[model samples]
Structure formats: C-alpha cells, structure tokens
Target: VREEAISRSRCFLNSAMAFTLYTYPNNYRAIKSLIAAEYTGLEIVVPDEFKFPGDVRSEAFKAKSPVQKVPVLETPDGCLFESNAILRHVARYRPEANLYGGPFYEQGLVDQWLDFSAFELEPPRNVWLYPILGYMKYDKRAAGKARNDVEKALTVLEDHLLLRTFIVGERITLADIALGSALIAPFEKVFDAKFREKFTNVTRWFTTLINQPEWKAIVPSVSLCEKEQIPAFPKKKEKQPKQQKQKQQKSQAKKADDESAPPPKKKEKNPLDLLPKSEMDLDTTKRTFSNNPFPAALKIFYDAWDPEGFCLYTSSYNYNSENTVDYQTSNLVSGWLQRLDSLRKYAFGCVNVWGVEDSKGPFVINAAWVFRGPSVPFEFTDCPDSEYHQLASVDLKDEAQKAKFEALLGGAEKYDGQPLYERKQFK
Candidate 1:
C-alpha cells in the first residue's frame, strides 16, 4: 500500500501543472524552490505584482496564506506556503530527477539533512549574518556565541561531507538544496577565507554544488567572502541639561566680544517645527493608551485624532527574513525607536514584531505611525536605520487600513490572523 501510494504521488507529479510563486527579490527561500524547479523542470511563475510586505498583507494574499508570509506556491489544486515545502513540491515534479533520493532510507536521510539544515544550521547562520547585514543590531556577546554555534554546525557538515559528494546520495537532492541555500548568505557575508579554512570538506562540497549547471542556472553567481565584514555602529549624541545649556550660553556670550572670538553660529531649527501645529495632544493620547484598556484608549485616540492636521503611515522591516532571535529583533525595534526619540512631540506610533522567535521565522514586522504633518516626518526618515523599512502612507478612511493601525496601537494579540510576538509603542 505504501509503495502504491508513492507510485500514485509520482504519477500526479508527472502531470504537474504550473505554479505561481509569490516572493520578494533576492529571497533565499524562493531561491531554493527555483533551483529545485531547474532540476525537475517545473514551471514556477513569480508574478511581478506580488511584491514584498504590501501584497502579502492584502486580503487576497491573506486568504491564500492565513499567516501572511511568503514563498507561497499557488497551484491549481490549492496554495502551499513555506519554502521547504515548495521546494519539495517542485522537486517531486520529475521523479527521474531524484531530488528527494531514490530508496526509502535515502529519502529519510534527505529529510534528516533538511531538518538539520533548518534546526541546526540555519538558526546560527541567521544569528551570525543578520547583525553583519544590519538586519539586527550587532551584539558582541551574542555574535560571538552565534559564530561558535555556526562553527560547530559546519564541523558536523565537514565530517559528513568528508568522503561523500552530496548530503544523501551521489546525486543532488533536496538536502543539498536546503543546506546550500542556507549557507549562501553566510558564505557571501560572514564566512571569510580565514573562517572557511577549517571546514575544507564542507567548503569543497558547497563549491561543487554552486558550480553545478542547475545551481548556476538559478543563481548566476556566488561570491565567496574574502574578508570578514564588520557591522557599522551608530554614533551616540550627548544631551545637556537645561541649566548646563544655559551656563554654556552665558560662557559663549562672554566670548562673543573677545578680539579673537569667532562669529556666533546660527541655531538650526528642526524642519518639523515649521509645520502647523496638529493640536492632537500626542502625549495625552499616549498616556491614555497606556493607562486604559483597548476600548477606552482607542476612544481617546479617535477623539484626539485630526485627520486634516495629522497623517498615518505604515512601515515594515525589509529584511524581516533575517529576524530570528526574539531578543535581537526586539533590540532592532528598540534601536530604531531610540533613534526616533526626536519625534516624540510630533509622532505617536506602534511597532509590532509578529510570529514567535527561536522558531523558523521570517518574522513579520508591522509598524503604524501618526505624524503631525501631511507625511512622514523628516526626522524619522533621516535616520540611517530608516533605510531598512518600507514606508507607505496609510489611508485611515479605508476601514481595513484603519483596523490594522488600530491593532498595532491597541496592542492586539493578533493581526491579520497571525499572533503578535511583541509590540512597542513610540510616544
């Protein structure tokens, strides 16, 4: 019966139809599926309209993917989410490709490696690379531990690949696709020559995989890391107290009349200070939200909100696929909010990290901002950390958009059917 079921499955795949894959550009998860398609001759269409977080957040996309994540395979039968599952679906299209391996035991081995890739390899890889790539804030101690973990995982692979050409068998299987794709970011970003020296076997195996025609077909180039890349730290600004600032002004005034004194410097005004007052009482709104539950807080917020004087905007982290560790992602949000301190008087916002951490997360980030202007404040956009976010103006007139904003602001346990992992309010 088992054998018959397997035969039936293969028969169905043999006549497999085309699939549309929804994903963002340079998504490694999509790469795995594409590479598998190359091997099995599966037609996977990635629609140009299916963009990043926006499309994924739409009602249509949510219907297909309740969790609202990507690498969703739209098949004639139904839709499939999750990259590994999509890769496996593509791989099974041509039984002759043997991407899942032939014998039952070999198939089990492939599954093992795939599980290993996800459980052991990918987590450390993400932890190590995310910081360097600026997706997560750099933490010396966390990074050090992550590097050690990656080294240990690679050591295991090194021994396994010592005498074998591929992970499971002589031919490339889903295991190779999983592990190879998992390592691509690390090898290109963090695993420098010095680091690669110890894992000669794993390096050789990885090199062989990328050089293959199928890999080359999907991924035209693979640039191995030569020198280690370091994270760029932000500079901190020191704030002086009012009394200290007044004393400094007095001291500077005395220097103004001196023979060698330079001309007084003009004080630069904030661009936002020039805007007409919104009269929204943002501080009161923040306090109301903090002090009361969702219903009462929302009522206070709605009463104070002046659509003509203020604007609502939404933003999501572009590199959320790299958001693995809960603490690290929280820190990423913290860092951004800290930089946004200058906007306290002019902005009220909520940043939510959806999906739990320490799991397979391409965690989703949803942020809602209410600014005392017609658009996003310059101070918010001017920050270096702002570049990683995809910003869009929100139309509260649209009920759906308004509800999403409310969810973020009210600290809802779930948004668009996905559970909220953490929420931070910026007042």
Candidate 2:
C-alpha cells in the first residue's frame, strides 16, 4: 500500500515549474530563498520590475500570496509564501541530497534555525545596511539604532564560530544558507574591513561559507575593499585635561579585554529541570497519541522552549508517521540546532511538549514553553528525534535555572562541560 501511494504521488519533472522569485537583486530575504533553491537544485524564474514596495503590492504577485511578499514559490503543488518556507518546500522535493539533511529531527532543526535567521538577525541588519548602502532611502536615527542592534547580534555569532566550522552539526545546512543570505547585505555594505576584523571568527566562518561552490552559484561575489581613511576630528584648541586622557585609555583597555574574554562556562542546573516528572504532564491535551510517542511533540518542545532570546515558528508541514528522512533535511536541521546553540547565551527557560501527529489515530504536538534571557539565545539537540519522547533543558544565562536543569539530568559533568554553544555578549 505504501509503494502504491508513493507511485501515485511521484512528481515527474516536467518543464521546470515557473518559480517566480519576486524581488530586487539587493533584497536579503529574496536572495536567501533564491540561493536555497539553487543549492537544492531547483530552477528559479526571476521577474523584471518586481522590486521592493512595488513588488510587495502588485496584483499579479498578490495572486500568489495575499501579502504579496517576495520569493513566493509557485510550484505544481500551488503557491507558497515566506522566504524560509519557500526554501523548505523547494528543498523537500530533493531529500536524497545532502543540502538539507537525513533525518526528521535534522529537518526540524533546519526549520528552527531558518526561523531564527528571519526573526533575530535580519531585521536590525536590514535597518542599517540597506539605507546606509543606498538600497533604500536613509533614516539616520533608525540606521543608528540598527547598527547598534546588529553589532550586538554579530557579537553572538562571533563567539559561536570560534569553535565550529559551520552553524549546525558538521557541515553547511539551511541554517548557514539563511544566515549567509541575511549577512550578505551587511557584509557587502555595512561591515567594512575594520568591522569584519573586529569580529574575527564571524569573518572566518563567513569567508569560508560564501566561498563554497553551492553559495557562489547563487550569491553574487561581494567586493572586499581596503579601509578608507577617515578625516581626523579637529583637535580642541585647549589642551585636553590629564584626567580625561587617563580615563579614555582605561576605557579602551577595558573594551579590549571585554572583546577578548572567553564565553562563560555552562552551569549545571537550569529552570527546565523544574517541570513535573510525569510524561502525562508533558503531553498535549489536544492531540491523540498512538501507543508510541508522536514526533510533533518534540517539535512543540523545541519551538516553545527557545531560551535563545528568539521566537520560533512551527512549520506548516504535518508530521507524518510514514515520512522518510534524508540527508539534506538532516543537514538543514543540524544547522538550525547549531545556530540555536550559538545563541544559548541569550535564552532562558524550558520548552514543553504538547503532542504529535494528527487527530485520525496518531498523536501530534500542539503546545510548548520557551524561556528567554536578556542576552542569550536558546539551545537544542544537534540531531533531533522524529519519534520517541525527548526533553531538553537549556540555560539562557540564569544560574538558578542552569543548576536545576543540571540536577534533573544527573549532573553538569554528564553533559558537555562547556556551554554547548557559546556566543559573545554585547553590553
């Protein structure tokens, strides 16, 4: 019966379906989906004059998505919106490939990180990079705020890349794809030589990722230029006070130390350890479960328990009992999990599980919990499970929560002694 169903549903490659990517060349979100499609081996059709505010409101584009967003993937399956969602769909059809990953848990991780890229990193970068570079009209106050925000975000990334080659698991995944696309704007316009030099790890990771064959296929080459000389501020006519000079030197030394300090070690217990021990308490009331645990429950927990100071959105795809896992999906998932780890310093609290599967007979996940911290991002498994009940305890900078979490899971020694992921904290 499974074979028959698979045969019936097989999608034959006809003339590559018209996938209209409605975007300007410089739009970060648009480029992300476009590049993802390219890496996944999907053909993309770019439309002329479909740029910015014009494309966002065009009636022709609105037919694809009510909001008229760029990167609306028009497939034989029908129109899909959201750049990340579009990338997922395009990649899903080619699961055998390594671009995504090999397991259901991995795919979930990819989805999670892609959501992070859209939520946590892109907004401020766009605010500063776009206007500053002439991609859009400039707003001085907004641009300044954006620059500050981006610097903080970049610091987090800088710390994470210090230990790993890629964002997730072991190789490039959707996490890298999404982040690379988001970074394109700033790397090209706002992050000049000095800025890149300051974030050494980020510079190294980005340089390697973008140079990969897959990335180069879609993203245009970014020009790296020598630092331009800035005119010196006119010297004050009066001599500077000796006290002020000393203070300035002290401040500069402190800044250097702050940038060079290693990330804090992960504490043993975290707030997630406080949840009720019963499995029943973790299960979702809304979904029916088979005798076995449902896969969606894991997703609910991961999505909800995002301590990583970032919001996570669930994917539209329903968890299926018969779903086949592949390397591409797994890669994407792993990338997301790694990205989540990288942001752990900014997260707090535990995520809870609701259920998994749909109402017919199998169980489905419905609810979750997330704890956030002022400066940390959330953390999760590098490789997740589509089946089996799993719970993760993450610390987003709360010592008490970390202690509790460690107690629940035996001891801090059992888990990686170091914070699973480390990122720079910006004051």
Candidate 3:
C-alpha cells in the first residue's frame, strides 16, 4: 500500500505537477481552462479515459465531479469543477503575474466582466446558436429576442473597448480570456461578416486576443462566420387519414379565404429603376472614375453631365452651433456620415473644415456634394435640419462653375476666405 501511494504521488507531480482536465473534446467552456493553463504555464492533460462507449457516469469519473460535467480539473490538492472556478484557480496560482489583477479594485473589475460575459453574453448566444444547430427546437421569436440581447450586450462592450486595446488594462487579463472563450462559439457559428462589421471595436478586441500565443494553442485559427445558418426543421408529417385530412384541408381553405390576398406584383422595386428612361452614358462615366486616369474622370464628369437627372450642391456643418470641442464635433460628423453611408451609391461629397479650434471665428465646415437626383434624395434631407448649415445648389453650366468645381475637387486651402484645417471625402 505504501509503494502504491508513492507511485500515485509520482504520477501527479511528473515534470511540472500534472493536472488532468476532463471535458468533451472541442468544448467551448473547456477552452477557458486550456487558455488559463497556457497563460499560467501549467500543464493540464485532457483525459481520454472516458470514450463514447464508456460511460461518463462511471465510478472513476463521477468520483471527480458529481454531476458528470466536463471541464473538471484534478490538481494534487483536490478536484476543481466549473470552468470559471477552474480559471480562477489556475490564474491565482500565478498571482504574481497579476492575471487576476492586484490592488483589489482591478481584481474586482475582472470578476465583474467575467460574470457579465457569462450572464449577458453566453446565454443569449446559446439561444441564438443552439437552435440553429438543431441542438434545440427553433422558435423565431426566441431567436429574435436572443439576437437582440446579444446585440445589446455587444453594443455596451463596444463602447467599453472603443478607447482601450484590452478589456481591463493595456494587456491580456482573465476578463479577456474568459470573455474570449465565451464568444468563440458565436464567432465560429453566428457572428458572420455583416454582423461583425457592425461592431468594429468588438472585432478588434477579439482578433487581438485570439492571435496571442495563449489562445493559438487551443484555437489555432478562427474563420469569421461567412454564411448564416438556417434552422434544420423537421419535415411535415404525411400519411394522414382521409377524414382527418379533409377536416384539416377545410380549416386551412376557410382560413385562406378569410385572409386578404396580396396585391399583384408590378415592376421591380429598385430606386434606380424609378427614373424616366435615359440615354445618358452614366455607366461609362462611373467606370472611368474606377478604371481610368484622373483626366478621364474629368472628361466623363464634363461630357456626360446630366443637369435634369443629377444635381451639384455644397453644405457646411453648423459649426458655430456646436459646443466647439474639435474631436467631439469631428465624431459627430463621422457618426452622421455612417448614418448616411446607405446613400453612397447615389452621392459623393468633399466635406472640409477650416482654421484651428476657436480660431478665425469658429472653424467653418463646408461640403461640396454631387447627388444623383434633381432634389436632394430623401435620405440626405431626412436627417434633422440644423440651422448652422449653409446649403446652395451649383449649376455646372454657369460661367464660373469650372473654377468653383476645380477648387472643391482640390479640397481648396481657402473656401469662402478661410484657411483649411482638414478635409474628409465621402465617396
């Protein structure tokens, strides 16, 4: 008995204190501990002792975790279950590294974000994900609610990360590792290209975490979700009895008759299709802008210009109306532009600012715009009107139009007698 006890002790402490992690392979929650182990430089051996045919409820496995849950970690001291608990244990072992943080307050922040990730992020993500994978029955309302919850959480997270590189401090921490692991399933399954684009800050934070050596050991590569998953619904049951079928058919027919039939389709619903047919060579003009020299762009603009179908205009932000902090007001313009991005296919603008902060009588903001319609598209005008703006239409056929156009195109150093401070293009 003495020899056997010494042998077990030897097995537990080979090289660097061998710890065993019990989890089903490729489990996301299990990844938390794997990453923590990597960061703490601890060896955590994943057990293959229980295979599919073998039972997880076997006496040996159950002895470690009463619930037969995966990701139970066995240290020489004792068995640690729960992924988050295991992460805390591993990180605290290397407390001098400050994985959990020091100074009391920093550790509290890590704990708060860890809990936020679990409650706010993980559950809703599962609701949105598992149903699509056929792991749970798909309910449209439930999926929508789950998606809304996730977007809400992500929006809050985006704001937190907008000014910082990492979640807590300058570098990686338990907050990031726990949240990164929690997000992996959704990143791989539902956060497709379009969805990811909406939360640029979150994408930046996630990409940074996964590229580190600690994360790469477990998740070597992650493909941003490209295709949205469709629910795998069970087929309708067939082979109904004739009397029962007739009853169901009668019910459906009566319901259909009661419902109003949809109106018949007409022409397609593209806004560009609404224009009176034109013989203008617009496509060649656009192609020139894309594929040809600068001179060709000028030629196309001059030769193919259609005054009846398109309009030229200039506008400036009501700069004097703003509180006058440079970066804040600049962000206002950027946010407005983001809101206006949907109109990109129909609009182009050269928006410029002049003078330094509080310099030369409240820096002027001017935009030279070319829009596709006679009047400004509703999309541009739909935004709340600001009294600070000065808007005017420019007729290209006017005698001085060429000079005005040239000045705007060059992003003029002086527009209306003010020196240029900055110029941003909307193309």
TM-scores of all candidate predictions against the true structure: 0.61, 0.48, 0.52
Task: Compare the candidates by TM-score and give the number of the best one.
Answer: 1
lDDT, candidate 1, equals 0.81
Q: Per-residue CA lDDT of candidate 1, range 34-151, in tens?
A: 9887777666778887678778767899899765788899998899987788888887766677899999999999999987887677776777787777666677777787788889
Q: How high is the lDDT of residue 21 in model 2?
A: 66
Q: Model 3: how far is 75 from its true place, Å?
A: 0.9
Off by over 4 Å in 1: 1-38, 41-86, 108-112, 118-120, 130-142, 159-165, 192-194, 197-201, 208-227, 232-280, 284-324, 335-342, 354-357, 361-364, 373-407, 410-420
For model 1, which pairs clash? none
Higher-lDDT candidate among 2 and 3? 3
Candidate 1: worst-modelled 10 consecutive residues by lDDT: 1-10
User: What does the lDDT read for residue 265 in candidate 2?
Assistant: 97
Q: Which stretches of candidate 2 lie over 4 Å from their true place?
A: 1-16, 49-58, 135-140, 225-427
Ranked by TM-score, top first: 1, 3, 2
Query: Residues 177-280, candidate 2, lDDT per residue (tens digit)?
Result: 88887887567655778888889898888888778776787764876545532223347798769999899999999998879778789887654443334333
Per residue, candidate 3 scores C-alpha lDDT tens digits across 1-427 of: 5235434534544665688887886677789878876766667898676563246547787798765556789998989877789989988765545678767898899999998887677766776887776555565766787799899989999999999998887767899998888888788878889999889999999999899887999999988789877688779888999999999999999998999989888966547558775555555555555566546567767777777777788776633422233433444455567667766777777666665663323555667777777777776766543223557788766757656665665425787776766666676
Query: What do the candidate models score in CA lDDT, each in turn?
Result: 0.81, 0.53, 0.72
lDDT of 3: 0.72
